[model samples]
Target chain A: MKPTNILFTCAGRRNYLINYFKEALNNEGLIIATDMSANAPALADADIAITVPSIYDENYISTIKDICLQHKVTAVISLNDLELPLLAKHKSNFNNIGVKVLISNEDVIDIAFDKWKFYQFLMKEKLTTPKTFIHIDEAIAETENNTLSYPLILKPRWGSSSIGIETVDTKEELILVHKLLLIKLKKTILYKASEKEINTAILIQEKIKGSEYGLDILNDFNGNYYGTFAREKLAMRSGETDKAISVITPEILAIGEKISLLLRHSGNLDCDIFIAENKIYILEFNPRFGGGYPFSHEAGINTAAIYIAWLKNEKIKASFNNYKSNITFAKCDRLLKIKSNS
Target chain B: MKPTNILFTCAGRRNYLINYFKEALNNEGLIIATDMSANAPALADADIAITVPSIYDENYISTIKDICLQHKVTAVISLNDLELPLLAKHKSNFNNIGVKVLISNEDVIDIAFDKWKFYQFLMKEKLTTPKTFIHIDEAIAETENNTLSYPLILKPRWGSSSIGIETVDTKEELILVHKLLLIKLKKTILYKASEKEINTAILIQEKIKGSEYGLDILNDFNGNYYGTFAREKLAMRSGETDKAISVITPEILAIGEKISLLLRHSGNLDCDIFIAENKIYILEFNPRFGGGYPFSHEAGINTAAIYIAWLKNEKIKASFNNYKSNITFAKCDRLLKIKSNS
Candidate 1:
């Protein structure tokens, strides 16, 4: 069997993914994990854990490349949203070193990472999404014109993982929180990403109250369409799905297929969709693995094994497609011992 | 071995504790967990998962008593701060039915649950703690008098977990946030707790800059001091210790002994301490099993087993005290499959 060492970058707390990949390797190859913080919990579970410079550091990419060359990493996967565009933009650098980066193209990353762009893409593609306004004036004007309503969500345009998210119940609160959020955004890590559109950094989105679903849209290395795994979010905490149950519906499956075919992204595409007013609205989509991927894995869709098989040029196993519906799972905390900084 | 069926009330997400107790029982007893929500992750880990009414409901105490009787529970423990006083106040109700509720006395619960009372207790006991002012006028006056400084923490006077906590850099921000916090506190479940002291429900505290430590002070069922296990917090997330390494210090041990002897808190007393400016300060204490218990457990302290032995009236095992220093652990998320609502 061809060695299938996997390198996970920006691996903050996805210890489950590291172990999954390790199991898939089955002692044939090693699992390498990297993060800016040496103490990131995921690092403790990897066969090899390396601490790299911050993604914004000048030597960050070079540090990653050095690790890749030294370890003979077969494929690199990023578990962070902010690092997705960086890896996608520098995919050729790894390719030149005979290392595969399992990231979508830069165009795909841009369309998925930028919330404003995501809204525009949804509009252009005739996909339903919440009404989003980039400017406070525009949002207030829409509210005045009766196009937008109260209880709007104010968040960073380039947000990840629930930073600086606020719900404004009234116009007064919206106006006040909008200013406060913009100020807070500048002090956050997202400021660097939002610097390009500092004026439109904050997004005022209509709040949709309904059931939320997380979709894992799989595609081949060639970006060919694969089956989708859907989970209805039963509970949410800290902006991530806390509890969810596997779901299979024609409407959700059809939408997932449409997104997969349109995006044609490699590996897994994690999409957040909300159903309200009997319409499916795409809240956002991350091209890489997301916090909700564990739910899909627990439901029997073994994407980690599939990724390894594809890397080894083996036929995809039918066993991986044994995903069943109504399988519920909730995220719980487990303790991991880290190497003491003695 | 007596069937020591354990019932954990308000068991929201302490799956680790549930499993720990289960392991200690060694299949000789059952772990019963209850929560207001049917989908609580901790409940799924327990042998008997139960959905109970909200703690504020009129029948809350009766429901718990009924569960204890139905499960033939030998011991009852609670995993929530707000529920601590409720359980403590009704200790005799459970005791009358021969269920040993593993909770502190009402006086200890009152001191720990009320942050203002906790601060006063620290002051009275000649223990060092952050200077706190419950009134906005007094806080502003203290700043103006040069007795206090900028960058203060404004939080609910009766705060549990990380709810309604804010930090203000300047006097202006402090004044603003204090008002905002008061308004926000009323909107939270804490409103019921803070209702009696609505006028002084917000506390402006000095922000201590230093290394934080979580100390688990173990006391037996009879409220006799057992030992103190301290862990220097390496990181914090959502107001709980994320990473910590066990540490042994004469000073910390002395403080733990003093507090344990004075408070005589039953079960585990989780205390938050800070070392800053070459002085040790007690930040707050929760008189129950805390999030940091797992770190102590992984460090070789078998408090779960100890509790079981105590309940069984067995001779205290010396092996249960085999704790060492310099052990570090970080919390990571694990998936728990929950029974579907269907």
Candidate 2:
């Protein structure tokens, strides 16, 4: 039998992803979703939905394994970035139980989960990125040397949801904002939430200007680059891309492929890229599906289908990037009716 | 030089088609549009808009020929079905002037332009079609023999815009509706308004039940079938499909290929198919882009690009019918901000 069972762990509000997978499955597979809350809208539409303990709970892994065994889930994935590290660290645990957890190896995930490490990794790949510095004195020296200047971004080293972030335009403002974030994030820095709290973990990088793009990079089960799609952000809402247009820039796709081949993340990898001054720059990486996936899918690139095919060991097209481009779309609020306490 | 100039003669309200052509050309070609009315929306967006005489005017052929010559147009095509027959009949007239008028041969145009002839051609092609009868006695005989019966559709032999048509349930209603259409159409039968008025043109066919489909079939410049795209009509308005979904039925595409190889119409040919009782049935055939071309194009099947490739002597994809299916779309009113009257 084919591996037709897909289980989404920590599937909080990703109903769109669930539906996309269901459509790709075309009723051939079962969608099993799990979250800490029974009221999560994303779980309402799944074939089987169960509430598991919180990610940090000591019994979380065993609870998920029990769910997988009960549902006969052959393929496993998660939408939560915090859950990825746990998934990766325990990938073998699931694999021993015949549940394939689609996540990258620990080394790749380490660089992805840290801003300074991601910067060094990109530099190693020979890809340009914004000049990033962890120490204020180093950044000030760069500014004095006229190599980089003010108008910099200060965010947590590996924070999710744009938490503890600040942008400054002048030297004094950069110093003040960096210090402010240093104290605020130290209160209880949730570095990916599921991991240990971090103190004095921050990233200050030069603010490059141009179009911002979100890429959905696909890889095989063995972390081999398959294809990549890029979308230029037209608007943003609450730190997430709201309106975007699919763009066909060879350099952007090339940069994504370079990163994928270097990092070797299995399955879908969410990546941030910058296009400025006629060149592409690499940015943050989230080793799972991000907010921009629906945009790619609507434009006719079915990453869900590609993922299922990879899981089934079926040969897919050489590149999922081959799609009709120039489509503009916006994210809209979708409500899923569910029982309040269910 | 390649055929870098495209001419749309008798263009009506198909502004979308014009824009699609402009995108495919990418500044490499010129789009020239013509219509009998200066207010034609499609012409308003073209690089060149010319008012041409009506098809029946004595100076019609000379006027189009002049437009082609003055604009240095290398390709000439029509959006009007009636113009297809005229263009096909006068193919050599355009060819002698060093212009390629993209239309099928006279035999194919004749069959496509006449419903009675289309029925006969389908029978010859061994394709399933709704049983049609022209004579009252023969229709009544079929009813008695239980071979066919009401509700029946009575319409003009080659009507465009569905001008003179009726659906009748009982035998009495069928006779009355048939008589009414016969008289009504005879008074001023604009069977495809761009052609000469026809008299005594009426058709009665069995109303097959099931979903209706709009097909866009592609052919090479030399009149060989490439492939076809199918869209199932979900909702229709004013004799046009307003909402539709891309459907992948291999038998339907195979039948289209079979018909195309037999008829060999160059470029885009819009044909209607009905899925009744789990069997595909051929309906009306329009030898030009119909209302459903946009739906097909949006689904990543680029007939405009395919057409340009064929014109430029480029080998297109092996088959146009190979596309991702199950995409649903709905058409809405779009406002074109044009001058009040220009």
Candidate 3:
């Protein structure tokens, strides 16, 4: 049999993807990996390693295309969420070259990136979700028009890992928070903005105070949902689950199944749901496999395996019900530094 | 008073935008428009028009930033959709030099460009929409597995216009269409693929056979929805409306209001809705102004005026309700040829 030449785009280094790919290689195929950084750890594991430009840049597409052509790459895969749009955008580019891109359309990537938009989608679908507003000004106006709620949450419409998330209780506090955010945004993103740009929008939602759970699911292109695993976040930083433990909950799995069926989602998806008042309210959906996905895999979910099998047209076990749950997994990262000798 | 130095980025010689800017200039402002094309039509109306590289390129952003600093530009506006993301990305660069970008976060622009993700959002929100799928392979597999209906439509997910759109009725036809698409993609986009370039994913959907209507709305940072106007497409080519007419439909307006209320969409947006079997299903939403929006201005719905007013934080009247129904507005173009000898 001819070997399948596969290209994987990675961010920094993804040990999880590299090891999984190696394990999944039952057939004689080559795994080529590319990253912006030359020192990426995944390079050690890959058959071919190359430095590529930032995925956000147009040149990245050209660079990847050059590599695929040179290597006779058959399939392209992205390990990061942000890279998905670029991958999807150039899917046809690969197809024209007889290379398959494991992506949906560019539109799917767009929706997946924006949390507010995803929440809006849930609302549109009549799915249970926390009350959310796109513009902070609207939330303020809503508060002014009525009375009652204190301690609402303020977040950027398209942020990840809770970059600019805050909880405010009063109108005065909200105004103060908004001012601070404007300054922070100008400093970090906008640089310095005039009065007009200072007033750019934010999302305000009725905060759900409860135990938060993450559901990991692997869905096929045919809308077949599999490997539904629910995890309780043991610890978190900046809204990302740093340490988590797999929990067996039929309710959460059912919710995951419902959302997967509704989205017709393909590939790995991480869904955040809040259990409050004995009700599950979905917060948002991440379309790509997350940093904490290894926990799910450790729980015998094998999300990566399912994705690989589906990509290769191999048979997959249809059920995940028999997998062991109530397993605890820990993930920790420490910054490394070396002293320079003068 | 000295004219406020306003810079326009990535605007080609599109006179519609220039004329609208001219009409909206209650306060004196020097309009300096930039495009890569020296012969861009907007050049004639600009106080100064300079050609620059494409906005997606990093060099273009650096060049524009330098020009803004040199010219002491006050505010920057984008007249093109593709330029919006680029402008948003370089917003901080302008801020360092004391210029304001009339855009939100770069992430917002990312969300707006993707259509399937937007549909997923609609479905998540429980909003009525045409049944859609992300990939042809997934669609075909699902149809085979679930006995899904026929007469399905296919299109490039991130594409503009009706390019590569086809309707298929049978499994044999679907397979043939998919193969042809695979071959065509390889030829055009993948020429670089063997060489490693990849580009946009394809989407397949169940055809919604019915009358389609479009709605234009303007919202402010405060999430104030205004300038709501409904127009029924009189004629369309691909996905663009070649000719359209302003119509006053309470039902359509109500739908637009619902979407705006849900998305809390700030700035200008055009929502395309399809009415089939006496039901209204939203087809898609464009975050920027539609190409045929000038027709609405002609029909007494001043979209440009409302947009500028919103930007300026000026009070805007809801004039859309006064528009008459069945007022046919048509847009047609002719190729002008000149004899060099003459």
Best by lDDT: 1
Candidate 1, residue B32: lDDT: 95
lDDT of 1 by residue, B255-342 (tens): 9999999999999999999999879989999999998999999998999999999999887788788899999899989999888767
How do the residues A1-342 of candidate 1 rate in per-residue lDDT, one tens digit apiece?
666778999898899999888887789999999998888999999999999999989999999999989998999999988888888889988999999999899889999878899899989999999999998999899889998898899888884834547777777677666665655566664536687778898889999999999999999888998889999998877677899999999999899889988898988999999999889989999898888999999999999999988899888889877899999999999999888666
Q: Put down candidate 2 lDDT per residue, B1-342, tens digits, no spaces.
A: 654899998777677788889998888889999988665657767998888889878899999999888989988878887677778889999999999988888888888888888999889878899998778778878888998877888777873733535666667666655554554454455555323534336678899899999998888878877788888887664467666678878788897898788888877888888987889889888888887888887776888878887778777764533465776655532323222332
TM-score of chain B of 2: 0.92
How many residue pairs clash per model? Answer: 0, 0, 38
Q: How far off is residue B271 in model 2, in Å?
A: 57
TM-score of 3: 0.46
lDDT of 3: 0.65
Please state the i-RMS of candidate 3: 32.0
Task: Estimate, for each residue in A1-342, the C-alpha lDDT of model 3 and write its tens digit.
Answer: 556777888734455566666666655577888988554556656788888888766698989989999998877877776677667777877889888776656656666766667777777888888788756777777787774276788765553522347677777667665554544454444212123344554667888889988887667756577657788876564355655667888788788888877776667777788899989998877777666576677667666556566666778765432456666554422111111112
Off by over 4 Å in 3: A144-148, A159-162, A186-200, A317-322, A334-342, B1-342
What does DockQ come to for candidate 1?
0.71
**Poorly placed runs, candidate 2 (over 4 Å):** A1-3, A161-164, A192-200, A317-322, B1-342
Per-model TM against the reference: 0.96, 0.49, 0.46
Candidate 2 CAPRI assessment class: incorrect
Cand. 2 TM to true fold: 0.49
As for candidate 2, its interface RMSD to one decimal place is 23.5
